[model samples]
Target: MVQYPFCALLMLSLLIFLATIPNAFFTQACLTTGYLRADAYQTRCPGVEAIVFAGVEQAVADDPRMAASLLRLHFHDCFVNGCDASVLLDDTLTFEGEKTAAPNLNSLRGFEVIDAIKSELEFACPETVSCADILAIAARDSVVLSGGPTWQVLMGRRDSLFANKGLANKNIPAPNSDVATLVSKFQNVGLSQKDMVALSGGHTIGKARCSTFSTRLKGSSSSDSPGLDKDFLASLQQLCSEFDNNNMTLAELDFVTPATFDNQYYTNLLSGEGLLASDQALVAEDGIATRNLVETYAEDPQAFFEDFKTSMVKMGSLKPLTGKSGQIRHNCRIMN
Candidate 1:
């Protein structure tokens, strides 16, 4: 090895110390084993995930509208890098001309929830942890706290080097994908149709902007057209005379239990209350497998949690620049 200046060597040692320290006892960057497998990380994620979820839950419980904002965090991340929280930065792409379907227009209320949780954590633990991890865990917890499902979580994920707005526009699946297309999209990210439907459970707890549902309102195409409960559709029409194609007027995926994580999302589908045309398609004639997933998850929260955990693991694995693939950033929003 080439000899270096004492100062340079000291700096290298310090960097290693910081990275490892984050994964040690000071923060939630747990170390059950090593980085070679995801199971090692799983042992550490749930507890932290619960904390984040609790903060989000409290932030939005009394006000259902806040759910939309909280839900946007997950949408922003997933669209960019399989729920990786890589689209919340100032440099990230915004929805551009011709209506780029990126993860912009996040719910402002949701940011408040994360900020509150960060404040509490800082008060309790000081600077031992990172806010980026809090964002990921909070998004996960928000779903569970909203009565979605108890996701099987893993820990030890380093924050992203950069948050890409442009990337979000390219990766997020639309609200109107057909079964085959959705399956392919999820597969590209190492998720299954089951994961797609379960992750889509986020829809149960949030509101859609009017822009997201404009096509549904006009019945643009069979897949784009929503098959909502008759009464709910009428109520939606009353809420907006014509779709503004904005976030304010979108219908939720599960209206029956929007604030709670339960089987009701599936039950809603069975009842013709599925909020989007894509959601409805999960149970359409040729979509029995997916429909059964809804039914199965509805019947067993434990099973759902298992699938959710597996799916989350798979989702995180997609296109990851791990093991020297990507550099850890001091700030999650910027590329170092």
Candidate 2:
């Protein structure tokens, strides 16, 4: 009986020893398959996150809009090809790039900022860092700088050599998409409806062009159509009226706090002041679950921040290239 107890204690001791192994060992093993981890660059490029954050902070200081722009860049990059930084590619004579995609052309900004960050990293760490990882880090910093929650971003993502303008156009959700369409698109990428609602909160800091939501002002012929507030619709019509040269005219997604990342977006939706059809669709009568989510977020900013961080991390993890699967480009805009 004493021998059996001693054997049981010995087995327990062995289990404890195994549990004490550093997580980096397991992370390194998973890296071969492109698995992302918080400390993927801790040894390879010691201060990569700080370097990227400094660049982002400087850019945002120069142009507050850059915070939103950087956030949107990561979204566009991930939605199309799984955050591979393919969206950063410039069109070459041989191949068209995603920059001119229907969803991104003239809409996506902040490429120069990303290029600057990549140049700095190339100087500091040479080819040790990846543009894909830079984008993920910049996005998290942008949110934090804009008064949002901060989360540890998974690194070790690799950049793609090719760009897909077609997939970008198809994958990036339209500003006019309804809740159901938005939910379906998110579901296609392994995200749930709740994730869709939470991620859409990103609009809290961005701007949209008149062309993105002018259809709402055009007025529907059907009486049962969900209508925007008359005053809000009138303002949008006036803002979008100069259609000839006003295509580039900008409107804040969340007018209440255009430069801050917060829950005012959901509150705007409740007041019928949502800038995009998709934004309004979240709180529409037809979307019970989504509307409930909007209500929850509107009533609780902390909940929105927590969920947004989780969803952003989830979004960033999609189909990344790692461990010799893709190259780390010298220039973010060109293949090296």
TM-score for all models, in order of appearance:
0.69, 0.90
The backbone clash count of each candidate, in order, is: 23, 0
Off by over 4 Å in 2: 1-30, 220-225, 242-244
Which candidate gets the maximum lDDT versus the true structure?
2
Query: lDDT by residue for model 1 over 1-336, one digit each (tens)?
Result: 899999999999998887875333433222322242323333333244445666777776667666556555654565565443455444435332211334354433455566676566555554323344565566566665555554444444444555554555555666677788778877776777788987765555666665555556554233344455666666666666654444465556566766666666667777666766667778777788998898887787667667765665556445433333344343434444
**What value does the lDDT take at residue 299 in candidate 2?**
98
Error of 1 at 149 (Å): 4.3
Cα error, residue 289 of model 1, in Å, equals: 2.5
Instruction: Name model 1 segments beyond 4 Å from true.
Output: 1-54, 61-68, 82-84, 92-103, 106-109, 119-128, 148-152, 219-232, 242-247, 298-302, 316-336
Question: Candidate 2, TM-score vs. the true structure?
Answer: 0.90
Query: For model 1, how many clashes?
Result: 23
